[model samples]
Target: MIKTNTIKSVGLKVPALTFGASGIGNLFHKLSNADAIGIAEGAIEMGWHAFDVAPHYGSSLAEIRLGLALRTLDRDEFVLSTKVGRLLMPRQESGLQNGEEFYDENPFNRVYDYSYDGIMRSYEDSIRRLGTRRIDILYVHDIGKYAHGDIPQEREYFKTLCNSGFKALEELKKSGHIKAYGIGANETEIMMEAMDYTDMDVVLLANRYNMLEPNRDEFFAKCEKRNVSVAAAAVFASGVLVKKNISEGHYEYGKVPKKVFARVVEISKVCDRHDVPIGAAAIQFPLRNKNVVSVVCGVTSIEQVRKNYEWAQWDIPECLWKELAEIGIK
Candidate 1:
């Protein structure tokens, strides 16, 4: 097994790589319970200590799976981060809240909720669901995008959550119930905006900084100055970086347009020049910077985890990076 390293940027020292649970929850497809647990456990055994899951993923089933896997590990060994904005509620059975009757469904089927009450409820519910004293990090998920309907009304919901969630998370940090507070979403602009409202220690950004485009320059500069660590996902661009014709919907992992594919083809040639696989280049590209401390790549199986972890071990030459830049990644 390859030993993992830690990035001591934020207040907490976390594994350089994390297992993003969105895919394992089978937002891609219904993953078997055993398979999810197996891959999650495999990540831990591989010396990875950071796990990122969100309620929006698999309709809250991702966290349930994470909690179940963590139950077997010594509590102090790992760092877990879950997002809010979409709260989880227990199924009501005969007027009684069905605590154990977990189902993966977002009640309103709404995009974002940041209400103060909703934020508190989300924190409380996550604690109950994970059966943990607290989460290491709680993010204001999808903080950038507004819901489709009711702009003013919907903004109020997110604002309430921001006001309540950040304060509550701060108190949780002080009380030792939470370790850190950050934002997690697929939006780059929103992550940068958090610097304005809150002094968070970490941010999880997906799709913004990947092999196709490295759009984190402004955020990277800010994080370096403030010591905020970034945990990136979707490095494969929803599995499009590796193969052509990726799927559509849910995180924009669809096939890179032929125009974009043109860039990747050139990138592949550059990686070929460097004598490395495109996969290896993709895995190592973001971490080349000092500001991006860790990357939480999504893994659907034990094999994918091993492949990613393996690629992470190899250091891509700076020459390859320069060559990639020449291919017009900008």
Candidate 2:
């Protein structure tokens, strides 16, 4: 069994493992509501006190299902984080569940909606969907994604929110509605940019700085110097680490490319030499930094959740780190 580590920084006690809610929504494929809730319960039973979800995930139903499962627990037992900057429009000609985004029939099809009104509207909708008076953490999701042909505009919008968004969040925070303010993006440079806009307490670096492509030294250095807690995610690199191309492997992430499979093969060799399962290495790899307060991964079933936790019993030996270091990811 993996002994859960609880971290305390900046007066906030964050769990070492956060179950990313994307798998519940089948962000990798398609999932049903019951399976999602079961995994949520499994995570809690295993000591994961924090769960991160976003409106972009399954049209925000992930949070709703989380809310439903959480209602079965004492609300104070865990932390719930969600994101804004993606608006929920009135369910269009199709219906509430079938609204359009940029004229797409899928209501979950999200475009950047970071205008102040749009950001606030998204927060309000998340509040209703979560069925909570306030959230523990609220992040500005993917301010880096381009929609209006100008990536700078999306950034500028987030900058404005970082300035004013904190003030608004302060109101909620003071009311005990929210715990922290920060940014969550699959990209890294935007997280670097967010430090200037808000008094960020934590940053979610999702898969941007993992073993396959570790190019986040500057970001991690700045975070360490500034006492910012980094929640490193996507450690599996979108299933590239598992290398399903191997006839014996089990993971299937959309479709695995050949080179990704080759690189993962190299990684598996190193892990085997160091006596670590590739999957175990994937779970523990993100916490290499002291500032990485947690690692977030998605699991579809209770069994999957247990498998992820089992990896915590092992750690990469320094020999493995040295070998991985030679691969030149500083």
Candidate 3:
């Protein structure tokens, strides 16, 4: 079984690895209901019960599929988390067009809303779709410049969140509807700024503090000081660090850049020298930081689920880490 750690602020214990539900949402390809549920069941059989999903993923398809997979299990047997942004609205057209990253999604268009009503409605909607009574963690998804870009419009959204949406999160926590609340952002600076507005128990940080880019010590220190636990997402840097050939995988949800590809090549050489799998190192690197409580990985196939579990459990020599540090990978 994977080790568990308690996010002290929320008093919620989570597994070392949380199952990311994006793949089940039909990212890049379509998946049958049986296949999606099988992936979740496979993770449960391997002793991983924590899951994270978002309304933005397949326009709520992931939440529905995950709900079906956990319908039979006892509610207290697992940890559930989902984001509260981008409420799904009915699409005018009957045909489905491929989204930015998700494919064959439900016939719904996502509207970004970060107001008080938006947060509350998003929470209730997620509950209905997930078929759950309570959610352990609720995150304000993609609220920074990374998703919205640095512009006047982005500042307006941030203002709305600070002015109105935060109240809903606090109410949820106080009313016991949710155990904790935080922001899910890819940028650290925005999260730092958010801390000034409200108290956050945890942050689902993605695409940063990973093997390919592991220079976020200052950010982690700030999180520790604020008593905010971090759940690291995109630990594989969106698959670049895990693939045997760097060219085969993507980075930051897009094609791998030349500069990033070169860095991974050097890291791979160090891994080869120590006979350690690059995927294992990438998955384990975030846990080395004291404030990071869990690493989130999305898997589609049962084989990928088994492989991720095995990789998380793989042992690496201390010398490998030392060499990685020498090469600026740590």
Candidate 4:
């Protein structure tokens, strides 16, 4: 079984590893129903009961599939989280929505809604799609410049979140609709800005505080000081850290840049010298900080699930971390 820790701000104990549902959402590729459900069931069997999904993933397809898998299990046996901000609307014509990363998605177009009513509606819709009474952790998804770019609309969305959306999250916690609420974002700057606006119980930070890029010390320190827990996602840096060859992996969901590939090559060499799998080191890196409660990783197959579990459990010598530190990977 994976170890568990309490998210002190919310008093929720989650596994050190969270099953990110993007894979089942058909990110980059499609999956058969059997395959999607099997991956969820397999993860549960492996004692990975904490799951994080978003409506933005396959426009609720992932939530639907995950619900099917979890329907038979005791609801109390697992911790569930899902994101808001992107409400699903029925698409009139659908083959593929433009600019979407998910493949073979459900026939729904996503609308970015960050108002009070939008958050409440999004939460209720997620509950129905997930077939759950309440979500343990509710995140406001992609409310930053990373998703919206450095535009005036970005500030408008942030204003909506600060002025009205945050009230919805606070009310949900008070009403027991959700245990905790925070922002689920890939960037750290906006999250830091949000810290000044409201008291968030947790933050689902992705790609910012992982093995390949671990220079978010100031952000993690702020989270720790504010008593805000962090759920670290994209710990693989979108598969770059785990790939055998640096060129074969991706960084930030795109082609690996030359400098990043070079850095990973260096990190990989150090891990090889220590007789350690670079993937294992990646899986275990973020948890070194006290405030990070979970490392969320997405997997598309049962084999990938098994591999991640093994990597998460792998033992790396302490000297390896020192070596990585020398190479500016700490």
Candidate 5:
């Protein structure tokens, strides 16, 4: 069995395998509430008690569905984390519509706001949507260049967060509204910059610290120094590390670049010689980093959840790490 890890700030014990709610939000395809709820319940039965969701995920559908699915389960038995930044607003039009960002989802629009009022409102909205008293971990969602794209504009917005948003989070934590506070970003630089404003209890970094791209040692070292735990999300590089072929792979939610494809192919060759499933090695790689507390994997089906569990516990030889280093992976 995969062992659970502790998040010191919240005094919550989480599985080494955390379930991400994006897939249940119908990230790519249409998913019924029953199916999505079934997947969440299945994950809980399979021993995943730490779950992460964002309002931006299916525009509040994920949180609402998660709340319904977990309603019967003892709330104290699980650790729930949700992101704040994109506030969900009811759609101006009343008729059924397609989702612009999230596939087929509820009729809601996302407004990007990271100010004090915005953060507090988003938190309250999440609580109501989740039907939960308190969220174990709260992340300031997508405040950096990766999500916003305009570097200068995002810099100003980030300053707004440092000035107001961080204060709101601190107030929430102090008031027992939230257990811990941090940032959920796809880049490493954002966390480093966030440290300049305030100390963080947790960081949800996605697609940046896997075997194919492990150039985060310095940031991990600083996180260790600050005693901030990390939840490694999208550890498969959005599918590149786990897919059977490069043609079917995706990197950072987009097509795999030629150079990256070549590198993964090389790594796959090494894995082949060692008789290790590349997916197993990929999922297990982040846990080897001392700063990483859990790997938050997205699942759309029970099979994916079970596969993740199996890969997390897969026995890997020490020589595989050495072989990876021998290649130009560094």
Candidate 6:
């Protein structure tokens, strides 16, 4: 069985591997209700009861589908989390295009609002969509320059979060509306800056602490020092680490660059020599770090869910880590 860890500050014990809900929201392909619920049920059966969802997923389809999946389960049996930032507003005249990769989703364009009122409205909306009485964790989603290409706009949003949005999260936590609150960002610098603004219990750091980009040692060290636990999201580096051929898949949600591809090739060679799947190594790498409490992976089908569970549990030789360090993945 997969293990679990406690985020002591929030008093939540989550599975070592949390299920990411993006794929169930019909990312890239349309998903039937049965298929989405079945995959989630399969993950629960396999002992992964923690799930992470967002309004941005499948044009707000992820939270709805996850709600349907967990409707019958007792609330205390699992841990649930969703992000607040993008508010889904229903349009009276419907002609909105779904998310770029999402097909056949609902008609609603997300409005990015991080004000106090916006955060409260987003939280209440998420509760309705998720069909849950309370959320265990709430994250301020995509508040970094990496997510918002405009640096000045990102800075302004960060300031808004510090000045007003953070109060809503803290109030929710204190009032028992949410157990923990933090910023869900893909970059480390902004998270460090967030620490200066507010005391967060957890941070969902995505795509940065993976096998290809293990450059956040200092960041993790600082988090440890501050007693801020981190959850690893996008641990497969978006796709390259898990794909059968590294070149066939994208990295950091886009085409892979030559320098990054070269490093992955070396890591792949070492995995081949050790008779270990690269996916197994990638899924296991973050758990070895002291600061990472959980690793979340996105899955669409039951087969993918099973494969991810198996990969997470797969055995890797200690020598592979040494070899990877030699290849510059350290």
Cα lDDT, model 2, residue 33: 72
- Model 6: ten consecutive residues of lowest lDDT: 91-100
lDDT of 1 at 325: 77
Query: For each candidate, how many residue pairs have backbone atoms clashing (under 3 Å)?
Result: 3, 0, 0, 0, 0, 0
Can you write out model 2's per-residue Cα lDDT over 105-218, one digit (the tens) per residue?
235446566655676777788888878777878787877753233567766676667666656655666676677767888776777776765567788887676777776778
Taken over the whole model, the C-alpha lDDT of each candidate is: 0.71, 0.70, 0.89, 0.89, 0.85, 0.86
Better of 4 and 5 by TM-score: 4
State the TM-score for model 5.
Answer: 0.94
| Candidate 6 residue spans exceeding 4 A from truth | 92-98
State the local distance difference test value for candidate 3: 0.89
Model 1 scores a C-alpha lDDT of 0.71
User: What's the candidate order when arranged by decreasing lDDT?
Assistant: 3, 4, 6, 5, 1, 2
**TM-scores of the candidates in the order shown:** 0.85, 0.85, 0.97, 0.97, 0.94, 0.94
What is the Å distance of residue 315 in model 2 from its true position? 4.1
Candidate 4 has which clashing residue pairs, if any? none
The worst-scoring run of ten residues by lDDT in candidate 4 lies at: 93-102
- Cα lDDT, model 3, residue 8: 71
Which residue pairs clash within candidate 2? none
- Two-way lDDT contest, 4 vs 5, winner: 4
Please provide, for model 5 over 203-312, each residue's C-alpha lDDT reduced to its tens digit, 9 standing for 90 to 100.
99988888777888789888888878999999888888777666784687767888888778788889999999888888888888867789989888899989988888
Instruction: Answer with 3 or 6, whichever has the higher lDDT.
Output: 3
Candidate 6 per-residue lDDT, tens place, 149-239, comes to 8768877888889999999999999999999988888899889888888889999998989887887877987787778889999988887
- Report the C-alpha displacement of residue 235, candidate 2, in angstroms: 0.9
Write the residue-wise lDDT of candidate 1 on 17-74 in tens digits: 7778886656646577788888888887877677888776666667778788888788
Candidate 6: clashing residue pairs, number: 0
Q: Model 6, residue 316: what's the lDDT? A: 88
> Relative to the unseen true structure, what is the C-alpha lDDT of residue 284 in candidate 1, on a scale of 0 to 100?
77
